[model samples]
Target: MNETKAATASTPGTHAHTGMTTRHDTWWLAPLLVATGFTLFIVYATFRAFENNYYEIGSIISPFYSPKIDLPGWPFSPAILILWMPAGFRATCYYYRKAYYRAYFLTPPACGVSVWGSKSYTGERAFPFVLQNLHRYFFYLAVLVLTILWYDVFKSMLEPSFHFDLVTLIMTVNCVLLSGYTFGCHAYRHLAGGGLNCFSTNESTKQRFKVWEFVTKLNEHHMAWAWFSLFSVGFTDFYIRQVCAGVFPNPVFF
Candidate 1:
């Protein structure tokens, strides 16, 4: 009886050692953490997007509301417009797709775990998954948005008196994190020179090769930058909102 039960448990297609029955210790922890963190960010961002009143303070604009476009007759939040590009870029991001797919969809949630959905895995070959191929295009838009945010950061540092402030420092840090993530993107690394057939043939290609190497180093820690930038952007927005709402006072230091 014991031998029969053991054999049945080890049989393929039984899922007796996979899915909820995974034998690997702490295998479920990673996906659970990812799901919790991602969900919290989504909820906070959604609330902030609709509650747009506290997005600006004096000369500083919240990261969430940069490049503000006010349409006199528009019915919805302007944030929706500015956010859509970054959101799309992130949605199509290679690392993010893996994280969310595991966390949210439970598609093979973790290593050694049985895959969810149908028995046959048709990965990215179908309708919505095909859209991930647009990541490169989204990377272009992300660069445009990053440029705008950097401009905002510079503006935040400029006061009539030339003194550094808390918001200025915060914006600077946010810009650095965001730039790290954006520049470290896989598409950006490819564009830098990953596609080159011959790096030694020309000086220009050599320079591009050097740049690609740097970006490649950055890519090694892309997942860390992704989470850091995600948190930084939201925190920056929240700080700006607090200042705008008179909930917190902005401090200055020379």
Candidate 2:
């Protein structure tokens, strides 16, 4: 028994003494993929936001420019006004925080892998990390933004003449994916019923529990929805931009 205890205690320290690392294969690949995908998205989004034009065509508005607020004498992109809220929301997303921290910061790039930061790690309690507490507030603002996006989707369907075009279909699908991403938010699930002490104590609480369960299921695949929505929104903007630029005519089906 004494030998077993001594061996167990010494095993963990052996890695540090010998400079040994994780045993997992391909540990670096996931973070590399995440970094590549996120970097491309940031570059593309920055370019589109600055371009400003081709954001609207007929009734189809780019997701980047939905609920467009024209600020008189404002020098920067109009997309700034609408984009900031969602941008903040996504930046503070729980899943995204884990992703960027791993991919960009190399904070234990993968499970079983060695962490790459300083020995002193103060997570989510210092300087910038403390700001993540604002995610819930961002969630509220995102709900409003999502409402406007859905309105855009409906408006796209109600063009003067009844016709379905590639842009229209893309915008509609974008809304759906965005909805999945937004509604599946961990903050939203908590808001639904996470604070309740007992679900059976009250009818209202029980009802909220049901809603919470549904949101929980959605939250399980939040990562998938997050990536899908990101690509879908960017593609929606690109499609609208291309069509508006006359690079390609919108194929319509009535």
Best of the candidates, TM-score: 1
Clashes of 2: 0
lDDT tens string, model 2, 85-176? 99999999999999998899766565545455335567789988999999999999999999998888778778776677778888889889
The worst-scoring run of ten residues by lDDT in candidate 2 lies at: 11-20
Model 1 ranges with Cα > 4 A deviation: 1-22
Instruction: Candidate 1: count the clashes.
Output: 0
Clash pairs detected, candidate 2: none
What's the lDDT for candidate 1?
A: 0.84
The lowest-lDDT stretch of 10 consecutive residues in candidate 1 is 9-18
